[model samples]
Target: MLQKTYDSQICSLARALELVGERWSLLIVRDALFAGVTRFNDFQHNLGIATNVLASRLEAFVDAGIMERREVHGSPRQHTYALTAKGRDLAPTLVALTSWGDRWATDGEPPILFHHADCGAAVGVETTCARCGAVGHDGVQVAPGPGMPAEYLADRRPARPPQP
Candidate 1:
């Protein structure tokens, strides 16, 4: 297990990371979203995660309001975990991360592709400007928002050089 880092930063990204930064956390979420896994045994079987680790992750998820646990009606030891609305909102984030891995980490064609189930069209993830509809990584810039910490403002990077 990796030691948790505490950031005194006020950024939303930082806060979000505090909850999901653990190594197995987001992978667990990914399994729940993409593989429809719910039971503890299923998560254990599919992920091969240690029992204590899985239990800790599940308990953290439940505490964070990302997932809700329900007891099996007739079973004492069986429970199902389901994503709450807040958890479902992470689908796009997972898609974005997966797309990044597919592009930069793969040797050839991607092993898996995402598609719309309704129309069966392949889907790609990109950041788009809401104002101009300009797409891709280069079209956006980050500015200091109201919530930005003063330390960050004082020690910011120069504007990135254009990609070749």
Candidate 2:
């Protein structure tokens, strides 16, 4: 079983993993984000997920503010799940992950392709230099961001070489 929390970790990625690292969580989000899957029954049918497990995952997503549960129009006792803005923000992450999986994990060709909605062009994710806007995946490194705890930051500081 996957650990439910990364309470001891001070990293953003770890925190994100706490929510969507589960085997089914990202798949749920993907359907909602891409397929406009909002109805509970639709999710169950599409994913072949157990109803109880879907209910639990939806409840957790609602609690986390990643998704909001709303009553379906004209259907009492029935609910549809909608992604909150915070949840929709995960699209790029999903796209990037898909790109990596297509390249590394899957056989043959990519099963799906993403494209821009406003124009007929391919959509992809890339890392870029913040200051110069140069595009590449190299030279990336982690450091303490402003929100990191002081003690954690101090402990994680990269060792410096002696000055000449």
Candidate 3:
């Protein structure tokens, strides 16, 4: 069985999960990205997260290179967290997750909307094929790639016989 920690997995997704898979981690990133929340008090006020948990999550983010902590206002005491380039790169992932939630989880209209900064038009995440243009979930297929471990390949169920 695959471990919940996924330490043995060689997949990129597994590696990413290790960094920001905790419940509060992505929300912290979301606030940093969309709400411009930086300070510990601001995060606590916005998220209502406990002090110790928030501190630990922030430290993990900093250690993972997703955020940087720096002193605020040249005061050796006060500090703020800022997203690094790696953290900003999670925008699309968050957007996609938001889109899905808005579709299937919400009761009424979406509580928040995303807009294109340049045109001020609503935007959403979509899957597009490089050569064939847009595609839906049914149009996508997974196959073993060069990065697939031999053990993973062996564990995969045998391909079904071709339909008659």
For each candidate, give its TM-score against the true structure.
0.84, 0.91, 0.89
lDDT tens digits, residue span 108-152, model 2: 999999999999699999888888775655456555689988888
Best lDDT goes to which candidate? 3
2 versus 3: better lDDT goes to = 3
Q: Highest TM-score: which candidate?
A: 2
**Candidate 2 positional error at 9, Å:** 0.6
Model 3 per-residue lDDT tens digits across residues 6-34:
87776889899889998799999999999
Tell me the deviation in Å of residue 129 in model 1: 1.0
* Clash count per candidate: 0, 0, 0
Deviation (Å) of 155 in candidate 3: 5.4
lDDT of model 1, residue 92:
90
List where candidate 1 sits over 4 angstroms from the true fold. Answer: 1-5, 146-164
Cα RMSDs, all models:
3.0, 3.0, 2.8
The sequence of per-residue lDDT tens digits that candidate 1 reaches over residues 1-164 is 54465565656877788778888888899999989999999999999999999999999899999999999999977899999998989989888888899889999998878899899998866677778775766666677788777787788776776689
